[model samples]
Target: MAWLLLIVGGMFEVGFTTALRFVDNFRNLPWTLAFFGSVTISMGLLEYAARSIPMGTAYAVWGGIGAVGTVLVGMIFFDEPSTLIRVLLILTIVAAIAGLKLFA
Candidate 1:
């Protein structure tokens, strides 16, 4: 279940990051709350998962998930760049995350 927790925690990392864009420098009340709430939940889960998983692997996977998820959300909702190279790089991150899981 540690892996499941890690994945969920990583998803929350994505949530908090994507929510950050809508925070408007902490002026938007709802988005600001979302950002903080997600941050807490994500960190809590990460810490919990780290109890069972190796610290380095858990952290790296969490970062990879957050990075790739944030980029995809930005491209879909915020009109961020979606060039072929960018997509390929995101895919590379996915491969790395998978590699970490496989080798762990």
Candidate 2:
């Protein structure tokens, strides 16, 4: 269940981060609301995940997942770079997240 929460938090993190550009420096009310809502949910779920998971492991996994997810979301939706280097970096983050899960 903690892993589930972590994934949920990651999803929310991706949402908020990707929405950041659309928010237009907080001038766009709808996007601003979405950004704030997603980030709030993400933090709440991260706090819940920390209750059962070790702090270092949970934090690393959460950050790694969010980072990778956000980049993928950006590439897919925002027409950001999808270079081979970026893919390799994302793969490394995935491996690190898996290693942390296994060792945790």
How does each model score on lDDT? Answer: 0.93, 0.90
lDDT of 2 by residue, 1-104 (tens): 99999889988988888779799879999999999999999989999999999988888888888899988988998799999999999999999999988888
- All candidates' TM-scores? 0.96, 0.94
Model 1: residues >4 Å from true position, as ranges?
none
Kindly give the number of clashing pairs for every candidate.
0, 0
* Top candidate (TM-score): 1
What is the lDDT for 13 in model 1? 95
Off by over 4 Å in 2: none
lDDT of 1 by residue, 14-76 (tens): 999988989998999999999999999999988998998899999999999999999999999
RMSD of every candidate to native, in Å, equals 0.8, 1.0
Error of 1 at 99 (Å): 0.5
Give model 2's TM-score versus the native structure. 0.94
Q: Considering every candidate listed, which one attains the maximal lDDT?
A: 1
